[model samples]
Each structure stands twice: as structure tokens, then as C-alpha cells.
Target: MAFPMQAGPGENGVDLPSTARMHDYWLGGSHHTEGDRAFADHLAMVGPLIPYLVRTQRALLRRIVRYLLGQGVRQFVDIGSGLPTCGQVHEVAEGSDPPARVLYVDNDPEVAADGEDLLAGNDNAAFLALDFREPDRVLSDPAATRLLDPQQPVALLALAALQMIPDSDDPAGVVAGYLRAMCPGSYLALTHSGPDPQLAYACEMFDQMKFGPRHALYLRDPVAVQLFFTGLELVPPGIVPLPLWHPDPERDPTLQNPGQVPVHVGVGRKPGFVD
Candidate 1:
């Protein structure tokens, strides 16, 4: 579905480029403005692998939802969910035996508004406008409570989302708060940009360009990313590059060379047996 792009900094309030819009552009969606396109093009020039990284991250998200569905997780909380698009959590979960409940959370007003409209008439899914850093607000929101059962297992997805949060915001703490809020047997499927030497120039460009005034990119090392899964049991193939994590050869035929992707992804389950 194409989102309407208005002149000037629409609804989101930031004059600078928006990460969500640029991501949409990279995904070949028509939800971005000219400024977002230009910013994405400039970044692509510096790091040609960026678009590939974005696609691989999206592929991993689909894999994650399917994996969770296999584990009998019927509820999902997708934090920092950007523009609604094909292969989103709810779309992937639509055919499950017991219908899945998906709650999409985003701090962007435009994303939230668009999501609410897109999910209209879909009783199993809803969207909330809240910052992922504020776990309390997200978990306490009426939409979340209405769709998610506190007693059941849930899959908390943060695909390519945590990288937008800087270090000073205590990303680890933010993750921990969500873990605390989720019940036992729940899962956390997350993907974050890794600190790749090849992308140093692009990283510098992001810092200097200030692509999004509200969102800053932060690439963390594997050791640091692992800390976010504290007190949880990581699934097999722990913290590997996006394609390497539970890869489905049939689905990702084009992802031949997985080593080129510089995003770390993994799923960790809370330490408790599901009754």
C-alpha cells in the first residue's frame, strides 16, 4: 500500500529526513518524500551494502515471525514498527491455526496513524503510538492490553529497530524493561546493525548528516548486543548475521552470500517452561 506524501515535513514534525520514510524508499515503497530519497541515495553512495542490509533485515523479520508461530506463540508485540507493509507480522501470522494477535508500536505519529487506518476492521491486530524505550507506556497502552494476554507467551520483535536508539538512552535497560514486562516463555527476536569496519565511512556520514533529528543510528559490537539478551536462553545459531539465522533456502534463494550482510540477529526465550 502506498502512503500519501505531503509537501514539507509532514506530520512527523522533524524537518530532517525520517528513517522510516527512507527505509520505505529502500524497500521500494512509495511512502517517502524527495528529501528522504535524496538522503537514502547519498547514504547508498557511501555504503552500497545499505540497501542489501535493509532487505536482509526484513527477510529476517519474516523468518522470526514464522519461527515464533512454530513455537506456538500466538501474540506478538512489534516495537518500533515502521510503515506497515507486505510481510509484516500480522500478515505473516494471518494463517495460523489459532489466529495471532499483533500489536504494532511506533513513536512516529504518521506511522501510528497510518497503521491504525491499515489495521481498521482487523480485530486481531492494533497499533499504538509509543516509544519503545518506554516499555511501561507500550505494555500499559489499552491497545496492547486488549490484544495481548498477560498470561500467554508473546514474541517481542525489534527488527532493525534498536539501532535507531543511541547509547545514552540505555538501550540495554530499555530491553530489560520489556523482558520484565513479558511473561515467562515469551521470546525476544531482535536485529541490530553490527559495527562493521567496511561501513565506518557510512557510520561517520550518518553522524555528521543527522539524517533524522529524533532517531540516531548506533552500531553495537556482538559482545554489547549479547547483553540485551541477559537472563534469557538464546536459540541455536546465536547472534549470527541476518541471513545465517534460521535461513530458509527456499524462501531466500537470492541470499547466497550471507557474510556480506552486517546485521546481527537472534531470538532469545525467557527462561521458563510453557505450561
Candidate 2:
């Protein structure tokens, strides 16, 4: 399903395939272009487990949000949030008593636009177009200030998003910036692609394929991913493979073979607060 290399702009003058849209395509969402499908298909052909990996990450997100809700964290800031689809934070959060306040952030203009449209009538959620690397901008944005209270605990989610950030951009520092703005009881729920042989080959293929700008994945080892949670207390079962993190048999029946997925996930709580 290779798309011919055509030299023309796509919708919204996007000449390159978008990673967000590719993710949407992987998750069986309709908000994707032919280019996105082509690129996603190419990677899936290389890794074979990519579709499963994507779904596993999504499942992990659902479980993480549920866990956060249980912890009484009512505000959520989902950085690098892609197209709002199934199992989105707002959907899962709003299902609980006293619907959680959510602020979705993404640098992609198209994704941000779609999110704005999706959340138009919903007062509990809002979308902000900003790069996660710019934590100050994300935290200072009116949407964040309005939806999330700085004095209260917040669940900051970076799921499957940090791998897109390269080392040169100071990924750990970026995490620190966001945590610095959060209250002591706040938590960071993160999932990053691990540095495995198969994933390395897939990344190589992705780079060779040249899907688009900022699409190159930076795989990190478990130790490296752990650094993202530097000062926080890792919740029990720290930094494990996707399927191993708080698996709910009833909800995630299809998830099998724990410790097999190359994506690392965990939730770390900021210290210095009680209740």
C-alpha cells in the first residue's frame, strides 16, 4: 500500500504525512489521509507487531486514566494528544462521578483543529495547539490555566509521545518542566517505545522511508525511560512493558504475553503531599 511520491500539498497544506494521523489510522479512526495510511502500512510491514503495539499503548492509556481517577486526581493534561477517538482521556474521565477536567495539547494544527471541533460543546474539555517541548507555553496557555488548577493534583499524560522527541531537545528536561508546574500530589503517566532490536530495525526502516518531518522515533532503554520519572515515586510495578502495567483482565482480555511489548509504561506520583 505504498503511495507514489507526489509533490503536492495535502489538506491544510500539509505536504508530509503526519504521525498523529498515522496513529489515528492505526487505531482504525477515519481522521487520516492516504499518505498517513501508506506510511503506517509501510512501518507495520516492517515491524509486523506495530498495530498490536499501538493498540497496547492505547489500552495502557485507558488503564492509566482509570488508575489516576481512582487516586482522586480530577484534572488531566494530555500532552501530544492526537485525534480524539475511542478511549480518549475526556471520554474515560467524563464517565466517572464529577467528570474530570481535561486539557488536550498537540502541536499539529490539523489535530488541534479536529480536537477543538470535537470538544466544541463540552465545557469540561478544551484543546490547545502547542509543542510539548515548550512546557512553559503549554502550562501558561489559557486553556491549561482555565481547565487545570495548579494548586490541586493533576495527572500529566505523555503516553507514546515522548519517543517522538529526540535527545537533543532535552526530553527529560521537558518532563521536568511539566512536573515543576504540577502540585506535589500530581502524577505523570508515560509510555515510551523501548530500544529493542526489532524496534531498532523498525526505526531504521521508518527513517529510510522518510515519512515526514519529526516522525523519527528515539528509542530509549528502560533505564533511560526511568529517568523521565526522576524525582517522582513510581507507583507499584514500576516501568514495565505495556501489558504488565496494571492489567485488567476483564477489560484487556485481548492483551496476552506480558513483557513482550517493547513499549514501557508507568505512573509516578509527585512527592510532598498527603491526600
Per-model lDDT: 0.78, 0.79
> Tens digit of lDDT per residue, candidate 1, span 1-275?
11112222235544555667777888888777888788778777767777777777777788889889999999998987877775789998899989999989887777677778889999999988887789998889888889988889988888867776778898889888888888899999888877777677766665577653333357787888899899999999999878899989889863688887777887999988767
TM-score of each: 0.88, 0.89
**Tens digits of lDDT, candidate 2, 51-94:** 77777778888899999999999999898787777678998887
> CA shift at 192, candidate 2, in angstroms?
1.3
TM-score of 1: 0.88
Q: Candidate 2: misplaced stretches above 4 Å?
A: 1-16, 206-214
Question: Ten-residue segment with the worst summed lDDT in candidate 2?
Answer: 1-10
Error of 1 at 229 (Å): 1.1
Model 2 lDDT on a 0 to 1 scale:
0.79
**Cα shift from native, residue 146, model 2 (Å):** 1.0
Clashing pairs in 1: none
